[model samples]
Target: MIDETIEEIREMQTHSSSVVAVKATRALAELTERDYATVEEFERDLERNVGALKRANPSHASLYNALQDVLHSVQGEADDLDEARELTVATIDRVVETVETGKRRAAQQAAATIEDGQTFLTHDYSSTVMEAVELAVADGAELTAYVTEARPRFLGRKFARELAAIDAVEPHLMVDGATGMFLPKCDRVIIGMDCIVEETLYNRIGTFPLVAAANEVGVPVTVVGSGAKVVDDGFRFENEIRSPSEVMLEPVEGIELENPAYDATPVDLIDEVITDEGVLEY
Candidate 1:
């Protein structure tokens, strides 16, 4: 019954953009009503909730890709699920690969602006940023990189672990709130974006603060994103907020709450946006 509900909610998340998190939240709420009092049950419930969350927002590429991962993981051993996941992962990999062709552009631009062996700071976990770092490392640049532990999900820990596993760039894990403390240690800032407006990029919620801090310190920040993430949003800004349950599993009665998933770094904050074709300044 729980799996059935999860599948249904997943479909709903696929079709609906605004309600993914809410649907995921309610599904877990229902599971709790079943008196799923065991730790395993709670863990399963948590997974489904996050899965639904991925289904919830398609506008944000990272979250949507994360949702695809959830589907693949839940049924990893099943032939059908494995096939679907492979196809999806392949598609994303192709897109990332194609976009990363622009890294040369960044590298060239970076050479003009930034020297080798310069440390940098970034908030949110960016696979694009990782790719760039890897490219720079391959060129023998010992760059120190800071990744934020995007909390409520602790996705940043995943980044730190992956970086350590790479045996290349230096990856430091810092709480989102403490990014300002380390901004001075880096030469410049770089982040991967899910979407770009002008030169600005949209990413995880706490990304805005880090960008702002970097800007105030007179550091140039670069945004890297794929053209596929570009859509006519028809708005100056878009922010994806997460479910309140992410922060409060058990809230006080009658208390209002808001949990947002993401925010934007204004176009003015970014120096340029790097894409596959080349780099753009908007």
Candidate 2:
């Protein structure tokens, strides 16, 4: 019964702006499907893992923030179901629609059109990229792109899978460890922001590296974010990196781990911030 409750909580978080939703869902799913002997046993393992998760990346803060909401429920604490559900649903729905909706698609299509026949590199997974690529494919634009795996969680797989479906979009899987190695090859690099701080952007954990590499290679970096990420002139970005234990988890004792949530890219590294409404040049 507790496992069932946990899964629902996992689902709730996964579908939110908190990207950890994906991994948390995976963890909870694994717990429920495998069936731990007791809540204490499960809670012990969860506390251990979540503790380690704090170090691997920066986004873990949000993951923990979202996880807190989950744990609160598991402990039988009551939440304002109507208000909470409404906020969660709206947050996720805006992000989803930001990626797949027609108005946003029109904007993406126009942005790509501004620089027709350009090759670009994008970091992590973005619905914005998918929409832009589809539009480019239909318009017969020469759009070759590179993607970073956005490691630990590897949300890049979703981006690659979706990119493959749209013919004419040449997408390369850039290894997280070696994304810098290929920077000079692309004309432009575009990243989607999970959060924008002041004018800076917080993307996946390794986004800082990509921005530095792009600047070194003299390639202009562009960002795509819904207006929401731009908080106060500068965007507020929270990068989450997950636990190193994600690399290995054993039922045995004496093992230590740390996971981080996300990373941030400064606004200076960005040449422009493209949104559905238009562009914000930083």
| Candidate maximizing lDDT | 1
- How well is each residue in 182-274 modelled by candidate 2, as lDDT tens digits? 777888887666667665566666788888888988998877655544556321233333446665665346766555556667788888777
- CA RMSD, predictions in order: 11.1, 9.0
Candidate 2 residue spans exceeding 4 A from truth: 1-116, 233-241, 250-256
**Backbone atom clashes (below 3 Å) for every candidate:** 7, 41
Name the runs in model 1 displaced over 4 angstroms: 1-56, 61-115, 198-200, 232-239
lDDT, residue 120, candidate 1: 81
Question: Clashes in model 1: which pairs?
Answer: 20-56, 240-261, 240-262, 241-260, 241-261, 242-260, 242-261
TM-score of each: 0.62, 0.62
> What value does the lDDT take at residue 121 in candidate 1?
78
lDDT of model 1 at residue 56? Answer: 40
True-structure lDDT of candidate 2: 0.57
TM-score of model 1 vs. true structure: 0.62
